[model samples]
Target: MNPKSCLNCGHKISDEFCAHCGQKTDTARITLQSLIKSDILGSIWHIEARFFRTLKHVLFGPGRMAMNYISGKRTRYYNLFSLLLILFGFNVLTLHFYLNLNPDEISEGNSNILEFFSKYSKTILFVIIPMLGTNAYFIFKRIKLNIAEHFIIGTVSLLGILIIFLFNDMVSLVGLWKPAAKIFGILDKASFVLFILFPAVTYWNAFKKSYSKPGLLWRVSVLYVLMGIESLAIITVLYRVF
Candidate 1:
């Protein structure tokens, strides 16, 4: 294969690395090895690193990660949507394994919580409405980030619930079921707050960008509280129907 010229400056290069700007030379070498090492493997490692960085920001700095993402420092971290998808997949995989190991244990626990989740899948998605709606309002009034961007962030918050629940289950091996359940309940509550916090913080940052105060924060927060109630209500309806 002929070496490609630099698209930036049209400088010639013999190998993968462009000597002038040090960019990886784009070429037709999309082979299995090249694709694996270059595309698949490289992206995986990058996403893994981003995922951990996101985790640190979320756990230690609360609201900071979402703010940074809105500030356009996004390439350094996973997009909120990608983070949600990865966490959701992980949650599903681990939850299946954990439940399979001791099916009765999950069923034996607080029947109320289990009943709540099992009942309301669609109503949970309703949270997306107020979430995205407020996002639209803010996007227009503040930083002008699109409404779709807010929806993506809201999706991430929902996925956080799955992640926290799985983390609760996995971390339980070292201790008894009772302690583990208590920890999980607390984490679950926190995850609910996180769902609301993500959008609220993002909107807050958008307002900050436009030299506005966060006066609407509390009203928006009430929308989230209603959304949370809607989530539980949907769960109850589902439990009865299904």
Candidate 2:
């Protein structure tokens, strides 16, 4: 047949998709049915599919996934920051609605800090990204990834950690039933231990191939120590300021 102009970029093409911009050669009019079925639902399904696939890779092989992403094989994975933000939002909602613990009930010294974090959890989460990124950049300098690429791995590790916390929040909902309340209570206490080990475990899994087992362990250890110190400094400054 004859060539037609691509509506998206004015590229001339005769195939089903424009060679220059990839817009479809056959465009449909925007009717209500097409908008709902093709635009809204299609977009939603696309995003959902990518999100779950990305989560599976992140959970099972975060290191390989991050390496793939850094090496430019990124189309298969969801955007790291986007996934982190989505999971963070869900975790926050779970904490607020399902596991709403009172700050006053926490230990005296930590109550204020807990309250502070509860109020500004999103901001705090974003702030922690850079801190984690910096620590990883330094600890894994031998890996040959730059600071920005290190940040990408940091984002993936943080996403895995958040998934752990999200699981804790979800399982905490089991406490609502009187029959499972005691068991969930035990699980709730165990969550503290999970929080401590989860990050190190995530880092270990993500960097296992990059270093020797012993070397990876020490680097992961130092990374957490640095993170703890940085967190303590931030909390101290916050306490003095507000």
Candidate 3:
């Protein structure tokens, strides 16, 4: 128990709920232990519940989860972009560490492997930026959220992709590139399925909430694919030139 105040009207409150404005109350003396017990660990559990719920709807029910999130019904579900960012950053850091430690394991035929990796590193930004921009557009159009919210979400998603790529590249340096490539092919197929499923589901719910049609919704998927290919092309050209 701690001193509490109304987050809404700044009224002091003793109970969990504020009476003056009928809003929730927040405790002031939050400790690290309390945070782990309440917010961090709790958020993780809550997010897990929300993730499964969203996944169910995202895979089969269609557009329901996004619609609920946009409607201010957030209680359990993970913040979409935050989840992506955590995963992405973790992947990238792990990959970077692995690559640096075992550079010789990455390639046998190429003495210029380091140069190759360095030269083409910038290509990732080209892919990520366009994807973020496109996702922002789709989020804005579908959810009617402001640009700022979409921008945050888009940034997280792009970070996730970058992490995946970094992981892939790092695996190449571990003498695992050949097998990893095959595994990645499988992942690519899986991602394609999810990519199609999520946007279509979100778009369907967007239609219900915002009354947008499916025809226009296809643009989001197109943009996603196009950005990916364009990024790959940029990398290829960079490799050829240098």
Per-model TM-score versus the true fold: 0.58, 0.82, 0.47
lDDT of 3 by residue, 48-88 (tens): 88766644543453345544565676665656666555555
Report lDDT per candidate. Answer: 0.59, 0.80, 0.57
Please provide, for model 2 over 19-103, each residue's C-alpha lDDT reduced to its tens digit, 9 standing for 90 to 100. Answer: 9988888876899998998899988998889999999988778777877898999888888888887899899888776635533
Tell me the tens digit of each residue's lDDT in model 1 across 1-242.
77678876688898878899887777555798989997899989987897787776555443345556656777777666666656656765665666566657665466566555444533554466455555454534554556665554455445445455556556643234675667766665665666446655544543444443554555456656766676567666776775
Ordered list by lDDT, greatest first: 2, 1, 3
Output the better candidate (1/2) by lDDT: 2
Worst 10 residues of 3 by lDDT: 151-160
Best by TM-score: 2
Greater lDDT among 2 and 3 belongs to 2
Q: Is candidate 1 or candidate 3 better by TM-score?
A: 1
Q: Which model, 1 or 2, shows the larger TM-score?
A: 2
At residue 197, give the lDDT of candidate 2: 75
Model 3, position 26, has a per-residue lDDT of: 57
Which regions of candidate 1 are displaced past 4 Å?
1-23, 26-45, 60-62, 106-145, 177-217
Look at candidate 3 and tell me the lDDT of residue 74.
Answer: 63
Cα RMSD of all models vs. native, in order, equals 6.3, 3.1, 7.2
